[model samples]
Target: MPELLPQIAEPTDASLAASGRRVVEIEARALEHLATRIDGGGSNRTFSAACQLILASRGRVVATGMGKSGHIARKIAATLASTGTPAFYVHPGEAGHGDLGMITDADVVLALSYSGESDEILTLLPVLKRQGNAVIAMTGRPQSTLARESDVHLDVSVPAEACPLDLAPTSSTTATLAMGDALAVALLEARGFTADDFARSHPAGSLGRRLLLHITDVMHAGDDVPRVGLGATLSEALVEMSRKRLGMTAVVDDEDKLIGLFTDGDLRRTLDDAALDVRTAMIADVMTRGPKTIAADQLAVEAARLMETHKISGLVVVDEAGRAVGALNIHDLLRARVV
Candidate 1:
């Protein structure tokens, strides 16, 4: 057997838990401080001005930063892009190496530097200025070169870092990230970014399917819809249900207007209660009247909600005139990932 290592004393459980809690408390306090600084009634007009500048810009929002700030900058750019504002991230170090040409007069630059003195960011300022690129600086230091040179300076000052050593990015990065989210949300509302617009951006996500996929896209339409005449027998309705494999069938009047619905539950209830004879019973005598229906143009998620709320498995898709145009079941919602 290999030699056993001697056990060393670890910190007490209380000490570890307290340490984690202290870090979270400190970060939470930092976010609270940042929120007050950007309040409209506050002395700082930095955030509102920044939003106005970006809103008026005809070109993209170019984000640039170094090190930890660069990571936050990239996330901020992504949030901006997804929320409606067109934005992209470019590294400050890469700006001098032919990337400076990408900056145009119509573009606005958002540069992040916690210390407000990143040499790479500062050096490219004059060139960006010459190109008429409006600069917005997110920094902890308001008097530093980067902040002073920028057209707008939004302070993301944090009282302390979560790091015990005070060197690692912790609370400061969290504050910066929260500030970025605030800016993106503000712009999102200002631009009227709707769920449909968000769906188009995230076409592969579940939220996209819920917002963009309509009942018409997944409901069984045309002759494939499980439908039966109002005068049809219960046995004939069962045949239609079987042929459609929907476990339910819609009963319509002579005008093809939906009159009632019959499902497997009704069949079980009928057999148990001896309410009707399957061989000769009319469908109108046993079907549920005024059943919940979905419009073909409604979102598939709405159908899923109706089914879930009513504890149902299927619904008839009806037109504005109450005609049976399609049929949708819970399985269809599942297949479309709307469930």
Candidate 2:
């Protein structure tokens, strides 16, 4: 038997590389084309019309689409709902069966399709129209049936697909995504949605914790506060700090206003000096003055910053009049996830 020759791999085709380059070029051109249309004179009218429909919606914005457009629609709906607008995704096929009942006269429908001729989407138009809900169409083809039937048509027309085969929805989907973002952001600004407002809707998110969680909510108050009088003995102050387990004690005046703080570091220094008298020495003599403090109503993250910046383990929480009302440490912030 003749020995089999070793098979060599064929070199990559230059035509395939050229095709890839062409796809990228088309995608870039599509984005540029969409950008130009947005700034064009007549295009503002289209945006204004879409904005009016969304602003006037008394109920949620129902987003529906088919195929790859459906995925983009879902993302658009999520972005809208999280930002400020009340929005949700509904499959067009589901709507034809029973989900059409979810939409009401008070709601607005946002339909997505690249060709603007998706049969699944078209099937619900008459029912939506009968329900008195306004339809806003997002499509690449303005003259397609969906756009023609829409109350407000948003032209997401891209020049071509980024796919080398020109069949896959690449550039068109990207343009559609960008347009949805533009709409959501525009509505977000129009509604004057703030960080606090966003936090209310996203209480479990990190941004919510940073914005909504105040120092007072997590600080140790009442009996947990480690406090000592200005003239209290070092031993007495240490006892209070140990009992509270806050690693520090606030030295307060008669009015309970914080004047100084004594910590483990202060105790260590006092111990280093053999001449220092723990029982006879006053806390006022050894406590560090001008200790860092924070307002109770301030964000817990801010308190964390102060602690980290000053190289301290704790802080005295003060009232509006600067009276020390509570105390918190690094552990408190860590437990609250504010760190």
Candidate 3:
């Protein structure tokens, strides 16, 4: 039978909060120390070399580690891939079993081990070195075997762990993750990676939607755009609005170019006036002249900003000639997830 552990009293609320705060403070200090190392400290040159190696690589970045470092490695790989540095994680244990084939001669290997002696990772080093793959090692021990053998070593040694017992991995892992982020961001800047490049790699995410989705992709174009001639009555404009269901209609001239806009808000104001008849009032008389508009080719997020800044719910998409070529509303942006 397995030996049972002794029971202990649960921590008080204040004690629990104190524990959380201490963890954050320790991790924050670790990150500060890491920043110093990259900011003109001894590790600055080696950090630059790591970024240069990744930027110059012709293939993807294969991130590998064991246990807790493996989790951090996976995250680092994802961050690099999404930020325009093509990268993927391979468990070092699995790599030895058959996954080493995933790596290639053109690839860069990023290995993480806080103690700098994870056997699973160290075992693959000989094979990786033989293949001529440049290795970047992140470890707490600069003089450790893995660090000494690597082409470039990033020292992630934290002063202490955040764990109360100081046995669990805490500050060390945080420092390692921060170093991985620093490498990724440095490579990103060196490669001139832009938001557009990021969006391409994360097309299903909200940032991708914001950066990649254009107004024309969401706006109602062609016959779907609600518009009426200047000579048309308010009733005719309402018909167009109801037919298009955009809550607004553009008022154009004989040349079919936008002269004004009439919306549900205008209808409410017009209704408040007993002197005006919906049947007889010309759209030009009741419509808002030169209302806020957006170009059809602009990003859909820009339309959201324009609507927010103007405190309006809808906008007429215009061409260079000031013609109403499209229409969109807050609802459309919501449907497109641009809101």
* Top candidate (TM-score): 1
What would the TM-scores of all predictions be?
0.91, 0.78, 0.88
Cα lDDT of model 1 by residue, 78-140, tens digit = 999999999999998988998987877899999999999999999999999988899999999
**lDDT at 333 for candidate 3?**
96
Q: Which scores higher on TM-score, 1 or 3?
A: 1
Per-residue accuracy of model 3 over 161-250 as CA lDDT, tens digit each: 999899999999999998988888888888899877877877887878998999999999899989999889888899889998989999
Per-residue CA lDDT of model 2 for 51-156, tens digit only, reads 8789987999999999999999999999999889999999999999998888888999999998999999999999999989999999988899999999988888
Clashing pairs in 2: none
Which 10-residue window of candidate 2 scores lowest in summed lDDT? 35-44
Best by lDDT: 1
Between candidates 1 and 2, the one scoring higher on TM-score is 1
lDDT for predicted candidate 3 compared with the true structure: 0.91
Kindly report which residue stretches of model 1 are placed more than 4 angstroms away from their true locations once superposed. 1-16, 40-43, 205-207, 274-278
Predictions: Cα RMSD each: 3.7, 5.1, 3.1
Off by over 4 Å in 3: 1-9, 205-212, 271-281
Candidate no. 1 TM-score: 0.91
C-alpha local distance difference test of each model:
0.93, 0.90, 0.91
